[model samples]
Target: MNLETFTLFNFWSSPLLATTAEAESSSLILAGVLLSLAVIYLASKAGGELCARINLPPVLGELVFGVMVGVSVLHLLMFAEAGEDGSHSLIMNLLQATSPMGSTTFSHVFEAQSEVLSVLAEIGVVVLLFEIGLESDLKELLKVGIQSTVVAVIGVITPFVLGTTGLMLLFGTPAIPAIFAGAALTATSIGITAKVLAEMQRLNTREGQIIVGAAVIDDVLGIIVLAVVAGLARDGQVVVSDVVYLVISAAAFFIGAIWIGRLLNPLFVQLVNHMRTRGQVLLSALFFALILSYISATIHLEAILGAFAAGLVLAETEKREELQRQVAPVADVLMPVFFVIVGARTDISVLNPFVPENREGLIMASFLIVVAIVGKVLTGLGVFGQPGINRLAIGVGMVPRGEVGLVFAAIGAATGALSDALNAAIIVMVILTTFLAPPLLRWAFSLSEESATTDPASLSGNISEPVLVESERLQSELVKPEIQ
Candidate 1:
């Protein structure tokens, strides 16, 4: 429908929707934002619930719903300008029949809206990483120690090699795109694995501990790889000193933040406890997270790193329970927005097998999925010397690329390092991995349990009681204290 046809709706006819006039533009933008939020929220919620019903991750449903409403499907949120023929673009239609305002005005309006959504999505990711950090115990991670480090190192290397090699061999992709593809594969989304483990009540298990620990270590390594790749993409050549600088900066940021956070958290908690206002602790925790996130961004690292560090610090405080309780609702609201936006960014046309031109993308996506899965699975083998550990389960748990992979792909696309075909391929690979991992993990865990009970001798190794006990103890410590 044209802009005029769209503006005929009583909703747009309201004076609040006027945008062509200079005086009314701000109000029009605000109204449009509110309307967009409403649509995104309702659509995301419905999609999440639908996915849950079918035993898939709610994220998959949210993403699919985003596509359904986005440019690829309904074209409800397209951001293009009107063609030379003067037909209204979707954004123009939403602007209440604003006249053909040329590229500059269209860019301004589009950017304003897109920027808001992007910021919200970024915040959602920050909250997510924060929660993961909060749930993690540094002490337990230490205990998992060398084993997890081994698994994580292998996890990163194997996927990267496989991804790069496969892309080059299968599609004869260029070096830069191959590197981006490899980098994308290296990310292991702990959120998906954590959710699956939590659901199956295996979160406190030995295997779970190793997976979580390895995933955490994996995150650190993945971020470093991302920095290097981003630098290479921008400069068109890798400078050793630049790479070294990023490594040092990222490492210092994490270690320094954690060290500083630990030292300051007690004082911060004490100050909050003495505050007369209710929820002061929660507010303080959030402020700290936001501050750290800003600092991380300022240092050219991912903001989520600082947010995660903030969470680790806060997790050590006396008010962990209260902070978690207060933060849960906020995280719940923002997290879905990230996943939906991720879906919305996806262009489904590249995945249309019926389109002859898109066949390469389809082929690349298929091979990428295989590479993503096998790469992570090999990490399970790194869990050596520990008998009775479910290696398959560990690998399967780490399978879902989830938001982490999407973040890498998004960076590549934004930097013009990845083509449309490659981006679509990465998105499809991410979606399939995210969707497939949970059920596979569930089956793996079930098999582990059955083996333990019915055919203990058939298992490769015995479950380590000491490790399991420590894991349980750590889990107990991580749990929020009950309010009286």
Candidate 2:
């Protein structure tokens, strides 16, 4: 064949070759993601079962196991945001071991798989918040006498002030790092708290309601504070209009979602009730959550907030019990993924004192940990005029830093606002605070068993009959699996 004819023939063949490579690459990515999920599910179940046998929260076990298999050790499921590529993940290595793929091709697969997993993790958390919302008593939270609001306000202000001032004064740290770390302290992980409360059958308790409500409110405030600090870090000064916009938008979105959802609930019920299709209630609720979640994300708020608002709105309807039943199985599948991811992303090697560079971060961490704990613990004192309430329980309930703190730390690191030492300190603080809160909460309530254990038959008026019934249902459901 002549040169022109030969070149055209090769060009036609090249497209087919490229298509085959693309399909193969896609398959590799899918395989990596599947293997990563297998690791996550296995780790979560094994950890959860062990914890259940040992009287600890199953989520904590999931977290611990996640840490073990994560960057700190097994390196099976680390994230790309943490600056690791395919070589860092054992899962990728295993896939390569099996398939004998080229290094470049496998690296691409690992990165793409990580991105997919990250998105799945985000959806998992959204499902978790939605589930918590379904279980919470929005009416009770409203009538809980403003304690949640007060605690949330105090929870934010106290930690920000204490952590910032303490970091600056004690360690002589610079303003940006100090402020970032301080803002990090304001985070209260509702995901972790809600899981513990549900496990303890305390979701309907006064303290549990107060903690859940405060955590939700704190989540809104945390986003605002993160924005403000992020602005101040990037620019020399905070933009008043920007902060005002965030505050106004957050308030409006949350309130507006609930109000509008209530107006639409009758129509929602009718639509679902009329559907003869399977998964009617579950799918409808998820659709509502995802739409609100999208709106919330567009407004620069957390998608979890919208999912929560969706849950709160639906919880007020007659179909709540049915919805809860349908959502439970789905939750059982997705919720552990969130917990596992949070744990997996955590790098505990920062806390190791044997390293010379870690000494400075360790000292700084000691200070931040104290501030993180004390600042949140002081939120209990804000429980004004309520006699016989376990203020310690209320305060301790807000202590865990969890994923929210990690977000602040990650942002600060990304913006170059936090130094290596400060970032390490923040990581350590998040890790320890998350580890302590569940046990501390259990202990705080344990001291005053008079309210529980003995079971006062007349906890009426303040707690609605529906709440009590829900609480009893949760307790019973803990032991027995429902049969179809």
Candidate 3:
């Protein structure tokens, strides 16, 4: 039949089909998508309200909102217990009709949702990290001194030992498994610490600098440990050759990435300098991030490390603030998708299975949680230069295991090292860390600030005081207002 005849014939045959087809039409789906967007936006606002009331980060609220719309929760909320299995519910019918045929398969649906969530979550993570990098001041970090390095080292060692011992004792897994699990717990989510410091107005303080510096070190240390763990897992034994290869390869990759970034940054800025339009500068920064990410991934490192390195390089440029401003909004909208997806992948159903039947899982999860928190907290003591420094606060600041921990566990799962229970435990750790860090860090910083205020000696006055003098001299010489 011709187009007009087809429409006319089917027009009234099934009102439901007709309506669905109409809804399936671009206009209808557009409306539905728009509605979804509205719901998500409202959800975000609701999250903000909950955050305000509970003294949690509003972003956490946004995360919870996403979970509500996720397949697990509210998606299931639409059905009565009886109708759930009958497949007669409106929402289910609509979802089935809208969902691709093959997508109805549980695995396929999961994979599709997973890919989408990963992308969104990554966007959130990238932007979040970018913001952290943007706010970082190298001079501030330097002023914090050997103390920060010491703190990160101590932090790394404590967690590594505790996690390894716990895994070995509790699970009696292979040596490699124990090593991988321990390595997973070693990295501190410095992003958490940085956010906390900023919230407490301590970002510019000496303690803040030490925490930030230690965080960077923690990243580097985490990667090194990850590489070692990965080598052991893959080789089944700590091969001397493999160890040397990984160490050399990682060392070379980082040094080379930095050298390359140094060279590329100037070239990129020059390209920006020659661009005809203002947006080109922003484009150049983005292009650099993409390139760096690709290069890092090519060498078997995290793309994030590359992205971070790119940001660090651009951080040195005069347009750092402008670059950050351009990147922030895009990152903000997309990054939380990563966190929400992380939550979604958790499969809380797994927890139900193990809870009463397998107390071992709960025991293991609790042990890991303690190791995770204690390892990073103890790292704070590494802030050694100043006597009576609030090392406890700094350590607590570094406690969350949001992204990096996930990366480690994911790699283990991918490689067949981590079993389902172990993987689930890791997910619990991630969720717990993400949930706990904001409030704990806030309290830690508040205590530090209170102490600093009460006693001038408690303030990071020694280093900061000198830096202010240098800043003034540079400001006077390097900047001049117009004589308008």
lDDT (tens digit, per residue) of candidate 3 on 1-484: 8999889877767797666654444343343334443445666667757886887766567656655654446552121211233142233345456654332342333333334435555656655655565566655555775777788788788888888887888678666767777888887766555655664567767677777777766777787788677867886655566556655765576567767777777777787888898688677787777786777667665566666666666788888988878887776566545544444333344456446634555567788889889888877755555886777778887788766787788898888888666777776777677668877877776786687687756466776888999999988776665422
- What is the lDDT ranking, best to worst? 2, 1, 3
* Candidate 1 local lDDT, residue 71: 58
**Candidate ordering by TM-score (highest first):** 2, 1, 3
Per-model TM against the reference: 0.79, 0.92, 0.74
Clash numbers, per candidate: 2, 0, 7
lDDT of 1: 0.77
Which 10 successive residues of model 1 have the least lDDT summed? 80-89
List all candidate RMSDs to the true structure: 10.5, 8.8, 9.5
Measured with C-alpha atoms, the lDDT of residue 139 in candidate 1 is: 67
Instruction: Flag clash pairs in model 3.
Output: 121-337, 121-338, 123-335, 124-334, 124-335, 151-382, 155-379
Ten-residue stretch with the least lDDT total in model 3:
77-86
Error of 2 at 331 (Å): 0.8
